[model samples]
Target: MRFLSKKDVPFKEVVPDGYIDIHSHLLPGIDDGVKTIYQSGYILEQFENFGFKKVITTPHIMQDIWPNSSQTITSNLKKLKDVLVPLGITKIELRASAEYMMDDLFYERIKNNDILPLHQNYILVEMSTFAPPINLNEILFEIKLAGYIPILAHPERYSFYHDDLKKYDELKASGFLFQVNLLSISGYYGEQIKSFAKKMIDQGYIDFTGTDVHNYHQLEVLEKGFEFKIAKKITSLMKNNIEFS
Candidate 1:
C-alpha cells in the first residue's frame, strides 16, 4: 500500500493505445467498484481517454460477498450502456464478465458450466491475498478440462507468493496465464507487489496487463503507472489482451 512518486511523462507517450482491458469492476452498485451510473460513465470516459478501445468489465462473483450472476452483470451493463449511448460515451466497447473467486461457489459454478468468461474460452479467476485455496491446482485443472483458459488476476498482489516467485512459474506451467495490474508497477499496491510485478515482467511471465480499475482514484494511479519504465518494457508482452482487442 505504498504510493510511489510519479515519473514525469505523459501516459500516452509510453503505453500502447487501444488495448483491451481484460479485468475491471466497471458495473455500478454490483460490487466494490463504482456505486452509481454516473461514476461508471466517468471512469469509462477516462479509460477511453487513457487509450483503451474496449473494456471487458469483470465484476466480483464471490458467493460470500458479491454473489453476482452472469444475468445480473449483463443487465447492469445494459443499464449503463443505455445511459451512456445517448450521452455520447460510446467510443469504448464495454462487455460483461465475472472475476470468479476460487472458492466453493466458483467450483460449483464450474462443475455446472455456469460461469461467465472474459471471451468465449478465457475465464478470469482470483484467490485471496492472504492465502491460496488448498485445491487451487485441482480447480485449475477442472477449468482447463472444461475447455476454458484460466487467467489469474493480479498475481503480483498476492503477498503469500512474494517470498517464492517460483510459485508464479509453477502456476504458469499449470496453464494459468498471469495478468499483472498496471498500478502494481507504480507501487500503488505496495513496494513488495511492485517488485514482484517487475520481476514477472523481466522474466517474460506476464501474459496480460489490466487497470483493475474500480474508481477515479485508481484510474489516476493507472495514468501515472504508464510513466513507469516497466510499463514500456511490458508493452510488447501484452499479447493476450491485444489479441482480444
Candidate 2:
C-alpha cells in the first residue's frame, strides 16, 4: 500500500488505520504538550479522525522540568476526559502514562513503585539527548528486577548514540525494547536522526512506533511521515504496539 503525506492528500488520510499510538504528550497544562483543555480535545479528536483505535498518552516526568507523579498524571487525565466527554469524542480510548527521564528522581520513583506504567508493566523511559546517564545499565537491571519492562523512547533521537549504533543492539540484548518516533522518518529532528531511524528499521531493531505528538505542528509532521518509505516498512513490524493496544 502507498502512503501519502498530509500535503499530498488529506491530513485525515495520512496514517494507516488501526494505529495504536503509545507515546504522546496530549494531557493539558502538564508537560511540553498542549497547554489547555481545548488543545487536548482537538488533538484527541484528530486522533479519532485519523483512524486510531487507542492512544496511550505519555506525559513527561522529568524531575527538574515537569516533576509529574502518577497522581498528577491521573488527575490531569481525568480532567481531559471530562472535557472530551462533553464534545462527544469517546470512541477512541485515551489512557495516561509517563515518559520517565532516567535521573536520580526516577530511580527513587522506581524504588517507591510510584510509576504510571503503560498497560501492565511497560515503563517508557528516555535519556538526555546530549549523553546517556551514568547508571543506565544499572537502572535497566533494576527495572527488570522490579518486574517492569523498560521501553526506551525514541532511541534514534539521542545524537550521542548515532555514531555507536551497536549500543542499540546492546540495549536490545539487555531486554530494553526500542520505540521509534514516527516523525523521525520524515527527518523532523534532522538528517542524522532520520538516518539512525532508518538504520534501526532496516536492522529490525524497532519494537514499536509512536507519534510523540507535542502539538498541532508536530502532528502535521507526523501526518507527512506516512509518505516516507520507512514509515510503511516500520508499520508492518510494530507488533509490540499492536499487542499492547
The number of the candidate with the highest TM-score is 1
Q: Which stretches of candidate 1 lie over 4 Å from their true place?
A: 1-6, 226-228
lDDT of 2 at 156: 88
Give the Cα error of residue 44 in candidate 1, in Å. Answer: 0.7
Residue 225 of candidate 1: its Cα lDDT? 48
Error of 2 at 115 (Å): 1.0
Please write out the lDDT profile of model 1 over residues 216-239, one tens digit for every residue.
898787676444455568566654
Residue pairs with clashing backbones, model 2: none
Per-residue lDDT of candidate 2, residues 1-245 (tens digit): 86564334333444556778899999988898999989888888988988888999999999789999899999999988887889989889989999999998999999878888898889899999889899988888778878999999999898887778788778889989989987787678887888778888898888888889999998777665444444447557554577677
Total backbone clashes of candidate 1, pairs 3 or more residues apart or in separate chains: 0
The TM-score, computed over Cα atoms with residue i paired to residue i, of candidate 1 is 0.93
Off by over 4 Å in 2: 1-14
